[model samples]
Target: MKQMYIPVNTSLSFLLISLFATIMPAQAQSAASAKASAATSTSTSTPTSTAKPSLTVTATQVGSGQMATKLVANGSVAAWQEATIGSQSSGLRITELMVNVGDVVKRGQVLASFDSEAVRADLAQAKAALAEAEATALDSIANADRARGLQASGAISKQQIGQYLTAEQTAKARVAAAKASLDVQQLRLKYTQVVAPDAGVISARMATVGAVLGNGAELFRMIRQGRLEWRAEVTSADLSKLTAGMTATVMAPNGEQTQGKVRMVAPTVDVTNRAGLVYVDLILPKDKTAAAFKPGMFARGEFLLGSSQAITIPQQAVVVRDGFSYVFKLNPDQRVTQVKIQTGRRMQVNGSEQIEVLSGINAGTQIAASGVGFLNDGDLVKLVAPSAAVGAAPAAPAAKK
Candidate 1:
C-alpha cells in the first residue's frame, strides 16, 4: 500500500516464498512420519541370538565309595648274590669252554678247563721225588739201626752212631717234604678246571678257549641259587620306609613281571650316589610259561610305601590337554565341562586291572568316558545311557536348612 504498486519481480518473489513455506511443512511432516514408523518397526523387530555349540560326549556315573590303595615306586632289579668267578692261579690257558653265557648250571658243574699238562708234569715229578726220598729214608733207617746195634755191642764209637742217626733223621724229613710237595701239586692241578660253585644261571663269560687267565681274572659271573635280586637304589628317606621281608613286584625290560621279597636294606649309603641299596630276592619260575625272567636283564621294581584311600579313574578316561590333565564331566544339562584332575599310581581293580586317579573326582559321579578330543567347556552334549559322568554335581545343601 505504501508503494501503491508492487514490482512484478517482488510479487513473483513473494509467491515463490509462500510456495516454499507450504512445500517445506509438507516435507517436514513426511520426514517426521517416516522417522516415527522406523522407530515403531525397530521396537517390534525380533532379536537375533547365538546358537549353543554341540559336542560329542560320553557319560560316566559317579563311582561308589571304594577302598583306594596307593602303589608308587621307581626301582631297578639287582642280583641278591653275585659272584665273579676268577681263576685262582696265574698263567693257565683255558683249554675247554663248556658253559657259555645264559646257561643254567647246577652246583659243581664243570664250566671250563685249562691245559693241565704242566700241572700234571709237576705232580708226577713230585711223586717221583717222594719215592726216591722214601727209599733213601728206608736205607738210612737200616743204616742207623745197624749203627745203633754196633754202638750197643761196643763195636763202634758213640759219636759215629750219633752221626748215622742224624743222617737218618734228615732223610726222613726229606721224604715228608717230597710227599707234601706232591699233595700241593695235586691241589694246584685241580684249580685248572673251573666249576660252578653254586646252582645259578651264567650271567657273563670272560674266558675264551685260548685266552690265558691270570689270578683273580674273572671268567664268569653267576648268581647264587638262581636267586635273582633286584638291587634297587633308594634314597636315605626311602630306606627307612623299606623293610626286609616286604613283598614287591619286578618288571623286566622285556615287560615280563615277577614277584620278589625284600631281603636286605643297606645300612650304609653310597657316598658317591647318596643312595642306599635295597636287595630284593626273586624266585625263578619253575614252569615254562614264566621262564622269561632272566638274570642280568634290566628291570624295574615297585615296593609299596603305604596305602591310602582316594578317588580313582580309569587310565583311558583321563585326557591330557596343553600339558595339563583334564577329565570332561557331564553336567545335569547334558553338557561336557572340563575339570582339572591330578593323577596317582595305577592300581589293580579288585586285584585285576589297573586304575589311576588322584583328585578332582569322586565315586559315583557322571563324567565323559571318551570323546574328550572333540569337546570343550560349555559344550552341549547328549548323555548316553549309564552316564559315566561321575560326580555330576554336588547336592544342594538341604536348601539352606
Candidate 2:
C-alpha cells in the first residue's frame, strides 16, 4: 500500500478558499436582502413624512363680543286672572244661552238668561203687597193723628188713645217689611240674567238651556281681560335675577313669540322641586288670531340678563362626540388638536350662529370653522381662505361651452 503525503499549508489554504467561497455568496445575498428591506422601508416611510391633510377647512378665530346673557326656563301659559260665572239665584231654569266657549265678552254682558216668568210674578205679588201696606200705613197715619187730637178731649179714653197709637206703629212696621220684600224680589228678577264679571274670553261653559241651576252653580269660566301670562318655573338661583320689570321673550309651542314683562316672582320656592315661579304678563299681538298662546299651553321663555363679554365661536365649529363637546383648534404646525369646551348660551352674531365658549378655549385661538365633525384629534388640515372655501358660482356653466 502506497501512503500519499500532502502539504498542510496547501490543504489549509484550499479549505480556507472553499469556506470563503461559501461565506462570500451568503454575505452577498444577505447584503442584497438588507438593501431591498431598506428600500422598502424608505418607500413606505416617505409617504408618512409628507402627511396628507385629512380635511380642507377654513380657520376661524375665537372672538370676544358682548352677548346678551339669558336665563332660559320652561313654563305654562295661563290666564292672568280667571273668573267664574255662576247662578246667583237658586231654582232658576236657564232659558237662553247667549254665549259659548271662545266668545269674547264684555263686563255686564249677558252670558245666559234664566226663566223670569216666576220671578216676575213674584215681583208683581210683592208690589201689590207693598201697595196694600202703603194704603194701610196712610190709614194708620190718619188714625194716629186723630188719636193725638182726641187725647186732649174726653171723647177718647187715655187707654184707648194709647192702643190706637200702638196699632199705628204696628201698621207702619208692616209697610216697611213689605217694601223690603219688594226690593228682594226685584233683585231676584235681576239675577235671572247671568252677566259677565269682567271683559274676557269665555274659556268654558257648563250651562245648558232648560237646566235648572242652584245658587252659586258655575255656568261659565272666563279669562279675565283676555290676558295671558307665562308662569315660568325658575331655579332658586335664577329667581333673584328676575325683577318685576325685566323683559322676557316667550316662545309658544307653535313658534310664535310674544314679549312679556315680569309681573312678579314667587315669594317662596317649591320645596319639592326647589324652584320658584315667575309670572310674566304677555303683550298680545294686535290681531287676536295671531296670538297663538293659550291658557295651559306649554311654553319656553328667556330672560335677558343683560350683556356680558364672551368668547364665542361659530356653532358649526363645535363637534359633539359621545356626550362631550369638542372643537378642533388649529396648532402652529397646521394640525388640529381636539379641545373639549364648555358651552353656554347660543346666539346670533353678525348673521352667523355662534355659541359661547364658557371654558376650555381662549380668545383669538384659531379653530376649524366648519367640517370639524369629520376631523379627529391631531389630524393634519389644509386651511383655505374664507372666500375660497365657499364654492364659486360654477362660472355660469362656462357659457354653454
Candidate 3:
C-alpha cells in the first residue's frame, strides 16, 4: 500500500539548502580566480604603446656567378655598303642638285648636274668634228709629201704616184674617223656629271632638279662608308650560333645601344620565314655628335651566345608560388627562409634583371629584394635601405666580370 514519513527539522532544512547551493558556486568561482590573478599582475607592470611590426626587406649576396648567355633577335639598321649612284648616260636633264640626303660624300663627289645643253651641243659638234679632222689630217700629209716629190721628179705619174698614195690613205682614214668622233663627244659630256661612287652618307636621292635619267638610271644611294648594318633575322635553328665574327648588341629605336660585328651568316633559309640572314656590323659611336644612330631602325639583337659558370639572382628574387619558383632566404637572424627556385638564363646585363640559379639554390644565398610580394615564410625582416633594397638598378652583380 503506501507509507509516508517526515521530520528531522524538515530534513535538516532541505539539507542546508542543498549544501548552500553547492557552496555558492564554489565561492563564486574562487572569487573569480582571484580577480583574474590581479589583472594579470597589473598587465605585467604596465608601459606599452604598441609596436612590434617591422619588415622593410631587400638583401642581395648571391655568389658563384658568370652568366652572359644571349641569343635574342629581331633587327634592321642597314646600308653597310650601299652606294648605288647611277646614270651611265642615257637621256639627261637633271641639271644641278649637288647632294643632300644627309650629305657626307667624297669618292668622286659631285652628286648631280645634268642638262649639258644637249651635251653642250654634242660638245660643240665634237669640237667641230675635231677641227675638221685636223684640217683633213694636215691636207693629207701635204698631198703625201707632194706625191713623193712628184714621183721621183717624173712629174707624178706612177698611176699618178698611186693616186697620190691612195689619196694619202683616204685622208688618214678620215682623220682617224674624226678623232674617234671627238672621243665620243667628250664621253657624252662627262656622263652629264653625277658622281659620288662611294665614301658615303647620302642614303638616297633620286635625281630631281629636272630628273631625266635613263640608262643605268638610279642616281644616288651612298652609305658605302657611313657604315651601318644589322639584319639579324635568325632562327634557322639559331643559324648555327652565327659566325663571321660573333658579337652583337643593337637595340636602338630610341633606347639606343649599338655595338655589333657578326658581318654575315645568311646562306639562304627563308623558305617563307624559316629564318636565316645575320649580317651585323653597326659599330658607330665615334661620337658623331651623339649621332642619332639611324637606318630603318627596328633593332633588338643580342647574339653573344657564350659565357657560363653561374648561380645568379635578383629578378625580384624569384617568388612565383603555385607555378613554383620562390626565394625569401635572408636568415642570419632576420628570418624568412622560403627558397625552392630552379630558373635558368633570363638575362639583361648592363641594365640588370638577371636570373639563372638552375636548381634549388645555394651560392651565398641571402635573397629577397624589391618587396617579394609581401614575403612570408618565418618572416621578421627589416633590412632597411641597403641602397633602397637592392633595386635602383641591381642586375650587374650576378656576373660583374
Tell how far residue 167 is off in model 2, in angstroms.
3.2
lDDT of 3 at 271: 90
Q: How do all models score by TM-score? A: 0.64, 0.73, 0.42
How many clashes does the backbone of model 2 have? Answer: 0
Query: How much is 70 displaced in model 3, in angstroms?
Result: 7.4
Where does model 2 exceed 4 Å of error? 1-60, 150-155, 287-291, 321-340, 366-401
Model 2 per-residue lDDT tens digits across residues 1-401? 12334576678999999999999999999999999999999898785546667677899899888999899999999999999888999998988999989999998999899999999999999999999998988998898899999877789898888888998998899999999999999999999998998899999998889998889999999999999899999999889888999999999887888899999999999999999999999998877534689889899999998999889899989999999999998998888899999999888767889899999999999999877867878877777888886863211111212
RMSD (Å) per prediction: 10.2, 8.8, 15.9
Better of 2 and 3 by lDDT: 2
Clashing pairs in 2: none
| Clash count, predicted structure 3 | 0
- Across residues 290-321, which tens digit of lDDT does each residue of candidate 3 receive? 27567776778788878889988878667798
Residue 254 CA error for candidate 1 (Å)?
3.4
